[model samples]
Target: MQKKSCGFFSRASELQRAPFINLPLHTGRAPAYLVRRMIRMSHAMSKVIIDEYGQVEFLRRLSDPLWFQAFGCVLGFDWHSSGVTTVVSGVLKQALKLDVHGISIAGGKGKKSTSAKTDILLLAENFGLSSAKIDSLLYANRMAAKVDTAAVQDGYSLYHHVILFDKCGNWAVVQQGMNAENGMARRYHWFSDNVQNFVREPHTGIISEKKNPCALDMTAAQSQENQKVCVDLAKSDTNNLKSSVYRLAARDTLDRWLGGDMVVDVVNTSGYEMPRRLDWALFKRIYDVQPGSYEELLSIPGVGGATVRALSLIAELIYGAKASWSDPVKYSFAHGGKDGVPYPIARKVYDESIRYLYGAIEGAEIEREERTDALKKLASFTTRMFPGQ
Candidate 1:
């Protein structure tokens, strides 16, 4: 992501009002310029986004929750706030207690769907679209693609997910999502199976607030039925997040980036320092590395087209193994959602989301001080809920 000099939406209307609001931060760390490296790098951001090392230092200062609130204002209170992207980029730092800078970022574009089909010209008959092009389509902004191209500093076609965070300079695929149009559910079998097993076995992690065994009790079987919602969602074809380039990197490459960034300091929270180099071997040992064997890799937890691409790249380039870059899933923006909507955009979820946000903001304003962090965030969300509003 690029660091942008976010000119305030307006100069005089800055006093905490409406969506583009501000807060009277009693305290804030150094000037944003001081930690220029840590700001969010968006495909659309034209400014010089901070690099990995600079991001680590910037996060150290944001470790204060009060600073978070204060900075939230300085950056504009909108989630789309110029600062929101930057803040989110570093927020994980505070919560995770790790420096993400210096981490290598990587991921692969599984497949591309274009009107054109070209298998005739290429020697090996590679498909028409490259992962990079797919990335352009998905990210639309090209921030990740730019970062990968710039930071890779190498000739080995990045072989993991299209995105990977190279923390400590060691690139590893920690989490990856598939993009193939049809196989995601089947590919995520590892997760599905494990969760299934977890439910079948004794689970101490989920504690109920029950006073009596029979008090408002649901049979274990029935409770498992309710838990199946997540399982069902995991398999859901509706607006799934599996193909997101960012999500793929966040999941697969998060550990690699976690350590290099000094994450905890970024969020002002106390937690273990993000580990140095997650054990990719752990995954490797448990799962077979059938490079380009999308069907096999998809069965592993956290494995997706991105993971397959990363592994295949490593296997082929680094280890001298050959693999294919065919997209793993069919690309679709709508996924399984209605072409338009079950209800019109002006009437359906859009209206509902706005009403809910407005009511929530109004209620908070009425119940407590009109100016609260909650209200500020609500305002931010509302702007997104109703763009022109």
Candidate 2:
């Protein structure tokens, strides 16, 4: 995950939208030789960072998309590959000396992601974090994943998720989603420091190479009024909400709402259609809770993409409140590329990352030969990254 400069989509709007470049997924694993050294170098580098700046600062850096990308480059991974998100996080989970550093990472790709809560529990126990604080951390982890996958639909399905935190409870989430049809990946980032609301523009950064057409961003600040409408619908009578959902689901009603012919043409070409079923039971739970905010409404169990989208459309049709359908991504992720999908490798940024790590490794208490070998490996990487330079 990386942050592109704001120049790609300069806007003075209050939202301060970040660019997300779609990363086309490239196959193959990080080589064993590289993985081994990555763990060693990453462990050494992370120790140096934490010792100098403290735990919160270390997590803050990890949360920055560009810094995380540079970290991957320093570890010899493809600088622009989606694997950087997973492999770098995996290495950190395995390499970080948590007992010494007082920080830990939990969750990962595929089946590993399911164990995030348990991992959080174990880490909390290790840090002696209170049950309430542990519960809050777990909720943050779950909601971040949910909001990205369910609330923000950009045609990508999340396949990897990770959360990093320290004993003091400052935390960050880095997760990636894949659009298998196009082989493109998008990574969403969350930092506790920037999250004032779990559902409203909570992401510290969102990265993709291209903006997804017709994608819905319920988290955008533009959706604030729509979010309120959706909450009001949730608190309204379940019977009326069901009737509204059914009307929106019906093809005839859609044709009427879309002004007839345009609806069919658009739906036929873009495969854009409203959800057929609404979870009325979920609506009942929402009504029972009578959530005061959209974030609280979204936090309820079983309130997923369909539920959110249905309410958004109904809110638009009945109350004339429109949610932002514009995708948050303006362009691709930052720095450079491995295959140069967006542009050639960013030589300066890559070189600087190597120099920083080289200095850190040299200053560590590791063997002198080890430090020399690390620098040699980095030099070789630099040569490969830019043959002429």
Candidate 3:
């Protein structure tokens, strides 16, 4: 079935609101003046920046295609809550155009309680790595079995740094650990511990020792039975939900998002100008807010300059949502939208974001020189992305 969009913004009091408002279209391309401004900024910031290869490597791996799909399965590890697995599945269908099945492993556990680092490696092992080696690694750590043979065999990939916002609790839910040394036995640290900083306790559901294959292997008819068991398990409703049910709910929520059934209010709005968190010299830009562009959006309660720039870029590049005002393209977030979806972008949110980002940048590890340079690059990219308007 052709999936549908999710429903984050259309609920409750906002039901009367259009799920999405028009993000008006702007005309023309980037201006030479803005380009020149960026160049000047870059020159001013021609010093103070360092590059770390490890950080880049981590970012690159987490962005891997296969890793994301496997992440969905390992997290839920089942049939019903297959949204995470399916995001990749859908993309794969378009790219490779191949029909693929992703198993899920979900139960009633909060994001904080799930250990993706341990679980992903477990899945990797199940794909073919020797459990004897895995077992030895676990034994050496004196860790208990929170992973079973079935889980290892069933899931193999994972995602890192996915952020989830909880409106009710007002907390950020994220997969906190993605250490490379996690799955490797030889590279295991002898005296140090990563688990202490891991977002949560190691999962306790998976049995370390292999049990009867018949019971452990929940496939086809058995998979159906497992689903039923999970449903019934939820009805029992104890202090702790079986891992399966929690996995189901979390996946369902995320799926609703993937399917566009739910709307996620992007916290990161139009980053009208470049981010100055890095040293200007390294990034080679000193681009600050474009006169009225960033401040106009930043004046909003939650909107930040970055969000403005981002929204502008997306509006121009993907949706063509424009900002308002005859103000030069350099002076506007974009051509304003009739309904003001992304353009004119939310004023309340934008300003708040700038204040937040400024603090964040101050705390960031970047030289002023590098920071200015990076901003210039961002401005250049933004200008190029919008071209002719």
Top candidate when judged by lDDT against the true structure: 2
How high is the lDDT of residue 195 in model 1? 25
Across 1-389, the per-residue lDDT of candidate 1 in tens digits comes to 11111111223432233122221112234356523422321110111112322433332223222222333432334332223323433433232222323322222222421111221112112223355443322331122222222211111122112221212212111112221332121000011111222223211111111111111111133333332332232333322312222233443433333442112111110121122232344344323443332222233345332333333232333233333221111111101112222222233423433343334334321324333544565555544323444
State the weakest 10-residue window (summed lDDT) of model 3: 184-193
Clashes of each: 61, 10, 94
Deviation from native of the Cα of residue 331 in model 3, angstroms: 25
lDDT of each: 0.26, 0.73, 0.25
> Each candidate's TM vs. the true structure?
0.23, 0.80, 0.20
Instruction: Name the Cα RMSD for model 3.
Output: 26.4
| Model 2 per-residue lDDT tens digits across residues 258-314 | 332112111111244566455556677789999999888888888888788778877
- lDDT for each residue of candidate 3 in 1-389, tens digit (9 for 90 to 100): 11111112213453233221111112243354533433332222211110222222222222222222222222222211223322322222222100111211111123422443364344434434465544433332222112111111222122222211111111111121111332210000111121321112222111111111222221122233332332232233232322222233343333221122122222222333222221212111112222222222223233323333333333333334333211100111122222432343333433332232233223334567645544453334323323322
Better of 1 and 2 by TM-score: 2
Q: What is the model-wide C-alpha lDDT for candidate 1?
A: 0.26
lDDT of 3: 0.25
Record all residue pairs in model 2 with backbone atoms less than 3 Å apart, i.e. clashing: 20-207, 20-208, 21-208, 21-209, 21-331, 21-332, 22-208, 22-209, 22-210, 209-332
Candidate 2: C-alpha RMSD to true structure equals 6.9
Ranking by TM-score: 2, 1, 3
Reference-based lDDT, residue 179, model 3: 17
